[model samples]
Target: MPKQIRIGTGAGYSGDRIVPAVKLAEFGDLDYLVFECLAERTIALAQQRKLSDPSKGYDPLLEKRMRKILGPCAENKTRIITNMGAANPEAAYAKVVELIEEMDLAHQKVGLVTGDDILEYLEAEDFPLSKGREKILANRDKIISANAYLGAEPIIRLLKEKADIIITGRSCDSSLFLAPMMFGFEMKEDEIERIGKGIAVAHLMECGAQVTGGYFADPGYKDVSGLADLGFPIAEVNVNGDAVITKLSDSGGEVSLRTVKEQLLYEVHDPANYITADGIADFTKIRLEEIGKNRVKVSGGGGKTQPNELKVSIGFNNGFIGEAQISYGGEGAEKRAKLAAQILMERLRILNLKFEGLRFDFIGAGSLWPGGSPSHIPKEIRLRVVGRTKTRHDAEGLCNEVEALYTNGPAGGGGVSRKVKENIAIVSSFIPREKVIPQTKTLEVENGSG
Candidate 1:
């Protein structure tokens, strides 16, 4: 008889801060533990790792945690997958080997999937990282990061090798667990519709209790309950591929209708046509419920066909940026910040540099206050100017030049200079699955390696 495979994920503030997810494997009958980390900036950091060090990229802290978790999982025989591989899977894989050895786990095979960091490799292939290549703006040399988000198929393939843990580079968040489920249940590709629906299910529940009551209305706690030990969500997916989102019995956070709705709206723009590499899921069909305090069940979640294209994220040389700040202590400080930015913009035009972009913002005065029109007023205001240039030096120059405004131009204002970092390249494309490979190869590592 086939075992009923269970899937769970660690949830956090932004999908990256999933400290609670580290404990998810301790729950009931978990066949696979999937950790989804990385966003636009993460890809850029991974690419930089490759350029700076060929054997760098994956997060070391995550590796350490995996080592600790694997001890118990290896005892129970659970497989794991994560995109923590970043730019350099070889280095990451070696670290995993070190951890496994420290735990003295026997017969633990760790599989690494690479080829996700193709930024440098693409340049070598004369690919030059063009924008809209496969419909994604492949940010060329200016790219801060480049990572290929792999789907679940490759992971499923790794499971066939009897690997205890699978490490990957930028695999889809849903693919982390869905791949294992597919492998365990022997799901097929022809069932693309079902596969797409499963991906949607994973997305809905990936943030753990977030879909339940964490983000929902919890008048009792004001927001989420048990703020300290909030539990992540798990899916008990059946052979038919249907999933139930739940958490450990003694975990934190609440799974309520409000939380589920918040999770549903996460990064979802088109409710009718949300596509993943696996399949397409319809947002309209999602039926959520508060089955228990920390349990939210989903049903009737199936949708239309997915587009042939895949969304690619690309980062490129957008250029360097410089920022300066000024605080308005006097009344009408909010008005001052806005005027200061406008004045600085004019000054730059006179200087003929004009800056690539410039922005003035208000802080503390509730610039973030909801509603197009602010309903309430606050005390004090901060006026800040940020400008970006094509080059780092140019940006620095602007920062220095702006500070001069305090003495020569604006009143009751002071300025400071700060450096900024490159975000990431988000490119969308439609590449046939055949064109991409999961890089399901492993490198042998010595005992107690770095």
Candidate 2:
């Protein structure tokens, strides 16, 4: 077995930058390049797209990204793993096959993990919803998509088959990175401690540049340079499941203990019991050592058995959201913005229009902390009025009222803008692991298809 392997993170989310991934494939000398693209609502959006067009449920940037890095990755022998398939792994697999043929890389082998989508298998009463369980059941007809999170077993099987690239739908984010380590080192499923260590490394690198200082910079307190050209992350994981997080030597971004710590705690509810599809990772005793510049060695993670139930993300058409914003400047900008909000409320009341939800905010004056007063007033404040309604027509009415403020209400209000959009809301549920089945399929490039 290999003593060590280098895995590079290509993306943190569906809309992450493409150039950083290109840099990693070209110069990172990576054995694996993993992209964690899907989020809770991203799959729902992809499902909506699939409903519109059968051939287009995958990541919108899938083609563009494959076109950019496929040739280089094939030439360099760097395998790729990504959940960019979102709602449709088979369609995504077909797209990649076409790209491989077009690029004349027919020798490449691609694999896809399937069966995560369990929309039909789910019942409204089976599991409680993350939000408004009763309301969601009441609006069950509007539900669009439901998908379970697959673990690394399917991906590991594909890797053992020597697949050069792997695509999946709604697989756990860290699984993409963990599969390579498990397959490369021939790790056992019951090795909870080792699995936990692998998970720690995967979590650190899963978000691409998060561990490399992309999201941790905070001006003077936490300064990071070359953020515009920030580099993605790479993990040099050893057979022991320990790893050193780093990046391309010439690439931009800092890799320090602070960055690693911030990423370690990101989105973690309880550090002692960070849960995933694979196993329960205990990060309470994880160690971080800055061994060299832009390199941090990480170890000491424990684990327990995997969760009995798998989490599923459900997407439904919640309602329509109408929003309008107008900026007011000068000494009394805050007061003017508030007055505009009052006018909007009065107008909506006069029209006898009742919305499911309504909100008014002064963008420059402590909108986030509604109860707190601003330390100082800003020269300009943007008044934003938003309303959620059952129908698009009713939502549009809220936008129209805000636009009217440009001429009738606030004297200094300018830069008026309005938008009405369908809100795709998300809810989470769980299903026993026995309910979901994951399997792998291999796709070979057609010999004469270019």
Each candidate's number of clashing pairs is 30, 0
Candidate 2, residues 96-115, lDDT tens digits: the string is: 99889878875889999999
- Which 10 successive residues of model 1 have the least lDDT summed? 10-19
User: Among these predicted structures, which one has the highest lDDT?
Assistant: 2
| lDDT of every predicted structure (CA atoms) | 0.65, 0.89
Q: What is candidate 1's local distance difference test score?
A: 0.65
- Please list the Cα RMSD from the true structure of every candidate, rounded to 1 decimal place: 4.0, 2.0
Candidate 1, 31-98: lDDT as tens digits:
77777666656666666666787767676456556755776577666677777776666777778887
Angstrom error at residue 425, model 2: 1.9
